[model samples]
Target: NLTTNISPLMLMVMSLERYVAVCYPLRHASIITIKNTTLSIIASWTVSLLNNLTRCLFLLQFSLEKLETLLVKDYCYDINWFPDSLRERYDKAYTCLVIISAGLAVISSYTGVVLAARSASTDKVSALKARKTLLLHLVHLGLSLSSTVYHPLLMALSTLVTRIVFVWVQDVFYVIIIILPRCLTSHIYGLNDKTIRPVLLYHLCGQLKISVKPGPC
Candidate 1:
């Protein structure tokens, strides 16, 4: 959950960095200095930690004894942990807030970059690549947000499917919604970044190949 929260925040930071770099190239160095970047990262992690701590407070209403008695399967789901109406409402509200705010920030940042890219002074190729990377960030954000609906979707499917089929479907959703998004960030950046692509591909392909020339974004 900490990682999930931090991921979008980090993406927002990246988007803003690109926004400044493309939209105001002359001022980017001064505006996005190493100290500022470090502080932004620290702030992001702090916010994520605080958010998760608040989430933990929701579990406090349940006594340890009560929690121990609650029946659970071999695997525990977040819905099971948050069985009460209060937690459910809080979860929904928080999820929507994060998705909307982060989505808007990223979209606005990328839109600015795109507009700046059209200017005669900007490097069109670099700006175009940044735009593509931002698009991927949006896709990743959507995938990450989809996990919030996983339980409700599974519950809806449970009535229509057989037990065996439902179990298989659950596994599929678990992988697609809960797992894949976390893994995509590395692949997205690694392939798009020229400096990292060769090294990423070398290790990914068992270190047999030392170089790979990828096409433009």
Candidate 2:
């Protein structure tokens, strides 16, 4: 959950960076420097870590039930363990607060970026680049939202229905949504940029020469 939290926070920061770069170009280099970017990342991670750590502390107050196949076959919900007051009420309220705030922050950041891309740039090349950047972030935001939600319901169904089918579906979604995003993030963000493409090609595929032409690599 903490790891999931970090991605959206980082993406929002990236959107803000893009906003400054596109809308306030003259001052962007000075305003969004390496030190500040690093600090922002650290702060984002810190917030996520703290939230999840508190969750862990809450969980540690109770003992987890041991897994039993017979119990799994009979019951979908855990009979051995029940939600205490902390989780039943407080945890949900806290989760809602965090979700609302973070979701709004991310959506606002990206929306500002898209609006900035549309209105601030007149140059066709610059505008196209900004659009592409926005598209990538939109895809990221969709995937991030999916990662937080409903398919876990399928996993819950596994305990009641045929255990294998829903579990497989859950696993497939996990791989596509969570694992692929983290693993292919470099390619998704970097490979399409002309400036970065040569470096990636050279390093990843051992291509000796990437002609620095003005077209697709």
Candidate 3:
């Protein structure tokens, strides 16, 4: 679960980078050059790795021998040994941090996209394309927010089956959040822009190649 959680956060950071590059080309080029963008990506990944590692440290502090003895097949670490209040406090803090950060990212990105689209410098075709891209990102932004919001409610819900169903639904929605932006940006921007043509083709060919691959990694 730690590994899985990290991917979404990394992707969110990538999406933010994309929004900056697309919507604020002039400023982005000046401030977020290739080297800076690469550094940002590395930083996001590093932070996520450290966050997961911190969770592991907590696991080490609390012994897991009993959980191992119980034969729980899939759990990477035991949480039950921690006091419920302590667990809930961590949960609340994590949820709040993610929600606020993601929300601000979405707002900033969306506003930038909107301003870019409305600019007098943007021609008709470019404006239309930018709007389409913004819409695609907005869908993803909404889903990301919904998933974060749903998580705490899912935890607080009384019924076990309801919680299970809620989590599964959120998981599927989260997958969509990962995939939709990639497809939309790659294809939609690639259609008209000579610069993004390679990116479009890359994602397209990549998808086809994955389709033919033997099995899931």
Predicted model with the maximum TM-score: 1
Distance from true location, Cα of 1 in model 2, Å: 3.2
The better-scoring model by lDDT among 1 and 3 is: 1
Per-residue alpha-carbon lDDT of model 2 for 33-130, expressed as tens digits? 98999999999899889877776565555654532322444335432233366644554675566556656755665566556656645344654565
Error of 1 at 108 (Å): 0.6
* Best-fitting candidate, scored by lDDT: 1
* Candidate 1: tens digits of C-alpha lDDT, residues 110-216: 88987888889999988988898888889988887887788888878877888799899999998999889888888777777788888888888888866578768
RMSD vs true structure, all candidates: 2.5, 4.4, 7.4
Give the worst 10-residue stretch by lDDT in candidate 3.
208-217
Show pairs that collide, candidate 3: none
Where does candidate 2 have its weakest 10-residue lDDT segment?
A: 66-75
Query: What's the TM-score of every candidate structure?
Result: 0.85, 0.73, 0.58
Cα misplacement distance, residue 1 of candidate 1 (Å): 1.8
Q: In order, what lDDT does every prediction score?
A: 0.83, 0.65, 0.55
Model 3 Cα lDDT, one tens digit per residue, 153-190: 43454244564675676567556654444444444345
